[model samples]
Target: MMKKADVGDKTKTFHKGQAIYKEGQSSGEAYIITQGAVGLYRLAGNKRVTLALLRPGQIFGEMGVITGEKRTSEALALDYTEVIVLDQTLLHTLLLKSPRPVQIITSYLVERVRALNALVPERSSSNTFASVCSVILLAWRAAARSGPKSEAAQISTVELSRTIKDILLITQTEIDEVLEKLARVHIVDIVDVKGTYYRTDPLLGTKKKSGEFVKERLLSIPDAERFARVSRNMAQDNPDANGAELEFIDLDDFARAVDAQPETILKKIAYGEVPPALFHFHKRQALAFAASKGQDYFQRAKRPRLKVEDLQNVDDVVGVDNATLEEALSRLGFYKVGVLAALAGDEARQKIYANLSKKIASVVREEVQRMPEPDPGEASDIEDELIGLIKSIKGISG
Candidate 1:
C-alpha cells in the first residue's frame, strides 16, 4: 500500500483555495500532500476544466519534475493542507536508486511524450507582446542547440516561423507582423542575409540567390515574461474575434487629413514587412493581393464604398467656406478633426500638408501613415484609384 513519506526536504501548509502553482510556470520540485486535498485544473477557453483532485498519500507534479517541463495544470489547495517539497537533488537521487530496467523505460517514455507533444495543436496567445516573448524563448532554445554565438542568440525567420506555427495557432504572416513591430521597438534587429538555397522547380532543383531574414538580439532579455503576462490579460482588448480591430480611413478626407499618404505603409506591405491583412485597399491591387495569398486581406477592414451623407455635426463644424477645404473634408461628411500627427518616416510627412486645422491634420496624418501602400507595379493602379476618388469628390461636391 502507498504511504506518506517524510523523506522530503521540507513541509509547509497552504490555506484552502490557495494556488500552489499555476499552469505554464517553470517546474522544479514535486509535492506530496501529507494533509488536506489539492486540485489540478486548466483553462479551456473561458471554462476551467478540473483534471484531478489529490489527497493524502498521493504524489503530484512528478511529470514536470521528470521532464523539466512547465507545469501543465494549476494546483490549488482544495483545503488547508500540509505538503512536503521534494527538491531536484532528492528527485535525482531517488531516480538514480530506481531499478535499471525501470530507469531505462522511464527515460524512453519521457522522450516519447516530448516528441508527441509537438504533434498536438495548441494556441498560447495571439497578443503581440506575448508572441514576442514566445519567439525570444524559442530563439534562445534554438540558438543553444546550435551553440550560441557571442552573447546573443541568432535565428533565421524561416526556422523560427516553422517552430512557432508547430506549437501555436498563429500563422507565418502573423509571425512576420510581430517581428517587424519588435524591430521597430528595438527589441530585435531584422537583418537581411544574402544566401543561396536549393530552389525546386517542376523539372529540376537548382541553387538560387535570395535574401534570408534573420532576427538577432542582444544577450539581454528584459521584462519579456512580465510583458507577456500583461498582454495576455489585455487580450480582451481585441474585439469581435477578428485578427485585429480594423481602422478605417476616408480617402475623400485624404487631402484635408494632412494630405493622407500611404506610400510608406504601402511599401512596407508590398515588401512583406507588414501583413496585407491589416489594410483595406480596393481596385485590382486588392484583388491581386487576395489572389496571391489565397485569402481576402482587405476584407478585415470594412468600409462604405461610397458615402453621400448629409453633414449634421452643426455644433462640431468649424466654418470653412474655401472650395479646396470644402472638397477635402466638408463634402466627405467625415471631419474627425485633430491635426498634429505624423507618419513613421520623414518621407511620409512631406506628402501631408494640413489644410484641416493644425491639430486635426496631425491626427489624420498619423492615421494615413497607419494605412497600407502597394508595390511599384501595383502603385499606379492604387494611385489611379486615388486620383479617380479625388476627381469624383470634386465633381460631385460642386
Candidate 2:
C-alpha cells in the first residue's frame, strides 16, 4: 500500500473555472485534490478539449513533477475546489525515501496516458468540426471585452477554415463550403479585409466580426424566430422561473454562437460548471448563459475589498496625506478610475481641454446641424467656449 506524503501547509482554494495552471506554464508542482473536481484540458485551436475530470483524492500534474517538463494541458477548477500542492523537489525527496508511492504513481501514469491517447481521435469528424466552431465563439466572447482591436475582431476567414480542417482532417475546400453555408445563415461573417480575396490559407489575414456582431447576426437569421419560441417554452418549464424577460437560444444555435459542439456544452452543464439555464436542449440563452458562466469564471479574483471603518485612518489606504488625496480627487473627478489630471503631462492637459471643447461643440453642432439656418447665438457661445478651453490648455501647460 502507498503512503500519502505530507506536502505541508501548501493547500490552496480556487473558485469554479479558475485555472490552476495554463498549458505551456512551468510546472514544479503536482496537485492532490482534497475537495471538489478539476478539469484537465488542452487548447485545440481556439476550443478547450476536455481531457479528463479529476475527482477528489486523485493526483494531477504528476507528469510534470516526474519528468520536469512544461505542462501540456491546463488544470481548471470544476467548482469551488481545494488542492494540496506538492512541489517537485519535495516529491522527489519523498519518493526516494518511499518505494510504495513510486509504484502507485507509475500505475496511475500508465492509466492516464492510455486514457489520453484514446480520447485524442475518438470523436467523429463532424463532432470535431463543431468543437472547433465552439472554440472560435468562446475566443470571440473573450475578445469582445477589449473592444474592436481585440484578436476576435481580427480573426480572418482563412484562419477559421484552417482550424476546422486541422481538427476534422478535412480539405480546405470542404471547410470553405461549411463557412459559406454558415455565412449564408448569418452565423458567421466572412469578411474581406480591404477588398482582398478571402482564401483558406492560414497565413493570409482577414477580418471577422465576433461577440455583439454574432448576437446581432442571429437576430436577423430566419432560424432565430424558431429559437425564440423554444426559449419561451423552456422558460415556462424552468423550476427556478422568474417573471423577468430572458433571452434564449437553442443548443445548436448556442453552439454556433460559441463555436462548440452541443454535446460538449451538455457535458459542462452536467458538471454544474455551466448554469442549467444554458442547457434547455431546445434553446440556450446565449447572453444570459455567457453572463452566468463567463462573469464568475473568466473574471480574475478582485483585490481584497477595504471598508472605511476597517482602516484606522483613511490615509492608510491611499498612503497619502488628506490634502494631497483631496486635491487629486477634485482634479480627477470622483470615480478616480484613471490618472489624476493634476499630475498629467502637457499632452494630457491639452487632450483634456480638447475633449471638453469637442463635447461642447458636439452638443451645439447636433442642435444646430439640422437647422436650415445655423443659430447665431448658439454658434457664438460654442466659439467662446472653444476659445476659453484653448486658453485654459495653454495656461495649464505653461
Candidate 3:
C-alpha cells in the first residue's frame, strides 16, 4: 500500500511593496490570493512591466511549482496580501485525485497553446501580412495605455520588430516587408529618429470622424481579413479565445503553462509527433512519442543546463528532506553544462559555473564516501580549470 504524504498547512502574508517571489528564484509553492491584490511582473528591457494584477480569490505563483522551474518573473504585493500555500506534494496529490484541479490546469494550458499556434504564419502572403498587422495593432494599443494624446501612438520600429519576432516565428525580412506595406497604405507613418519609429493614428482621416478608420482598414486588408477568419477557427477549438480578452505567449512559453519541459515539447514536434488539439496540425502519427517519456530521455542524454543548486533551493522551500530532494533532482532534466563556457564577464554566469563545480564535488563525495574509489585528482583538475577561466573573464570585465 502506498503511504499518503503529510503536507502541512502554511499561510503567509505580505505587505505592499514586498516581493512574494523574485525572478530566477526557485519555487515549489503555489499561492492563492486571499486578500488585497498581487502584482505579476517581468523585466522588460531595463524596466519592470506589470503583466497582470491578481485580486482576491485569484491564484499566482503556480507556474514555477507545476513546471519544476525557477521563477520566470517576480510577484509582489500590490497592497496588503494574504496567500494560502500549496506545496508540491499537495499539488501532485491533487493532480492525481481532483478533477477540478485538472480542469483548471487544462484550461490554462489550452489557452496558452492556442495563443502560440495563432502566431505561426500561414503560408499565404495575405495571412502573413494579417499576422503582422494584428501584432502592430496590439503594440499600438499598448502604447495608447502610456498616455499618448495626439491620436497617434509612437512605436519604436526596433521594439516593434522584436515584439513581432518574439510573438511569431518569422524572419526580420518578413517583418520589414510588412512594415513597408503598412507605410505605403498610409496606415502607418514611418519616422526616423535614433532608430526607425512608426506613428499609427487609429483615428486617421475620415470626412465624418466616424471612428471606423481601424475597422475599415482591417476589413479591407486581405491579410487582416484572413487573420479574423483564422481567429474564429481558433476560438471554436479553444473556448478561452472566443471572447474579447486574449493573451499571447510564444510557442516555447506554452510549455510552462502545462508544466512540461519546453525543449522536450519542441523536439517532439520537430520529430513529427502529433501536437495537442490546440495546434493547427491534425494528429497524423499514432505511434508518436509521449511528452513525459521524451523529457525523461532528454534529461538522460543532456548535460546540466541550469544550476543544480538552484533546483535544490526549490526543494528547500517545499521542506523536502535533503536525501529525498537530492534523489529527485538528480533525475530531472538539465541543460548542457559547457554551453555557457564561451560567454565571458557575466557575474551571474560565473556564479552558476562555480556552483556547478561545487555540486559536482558534493555528489561525488556522497556517492563514493563508503566505497573504495580512485582519487578524484583528474575531476578536480577539470573543475579547477573551468573555475580559473571564469575568474579570468571576471577579472577582465571588472
lDDT, each prediction? 0.53, 0.52, 0.52
Candidate order by TM-score, decreasing, is 2, 1, 3
Best by TM-score: 2
Write down the lDDT that model 1 would get.
0.53
Could you tally the backbone clashes for each prediction? Answer: 11, 6, 3
- Cα lDDT of model 2 by residue, 1-398, tens digit: 22345666588999998999998888899888988999887654323456689998898998777777788888999999998888888778767777897678776875687577446443322243344344345334433544564334435555555545544445767556545545664655554434223345456565553323221111112233443344334334433211111123345567767989876775455334587544432123356566677777656643343333332221122323334333333333221212222222333333433333455434433433344443456444433433333334334321
The TM-scores, one per candidate, come to 0.30, 0.39, 0.29
Residue 275, candidate 2: Cα error in Å is 23
The residue-by-residue lDDT of candidate 1 on 1-398, one tens digit each, is 22335355488889998999998999897888889999876653322445578999787887789888898778999899998887877777878987999899889987775664443224333344454444455455446445645555556667667655643556778777666655555555556655344455646665564545433423333344443454445434532221221123322223235553544443344435566555554345357656887756645854222222222221111222235333544323211211211212332233223344566566666665664553445444333333343446556441
Residue by residue across 1-398, what tens digits does model 3's lDDT show? 11223334577999998999998899788877768899876553222445578887776776667777787678989898888787888867766675887668766984684464343232212244555665676565556545456555566777778776765546899888767756665556666533233455559743333232221121122233343455445334433221122234434346656778766666445334545644632122212434435656655544234332322211111222334333433332232122222222233334433444476634433444443332356434433443443334334221
- Model 1 CA lDDT for position 304: 24
Worst 10 residues of 3 by lDDT: 212-221
Q: Supply candidate 1's per-residue lDDT for 156.
A: 64
lDDT value, residue 289 of candidate 1? 54
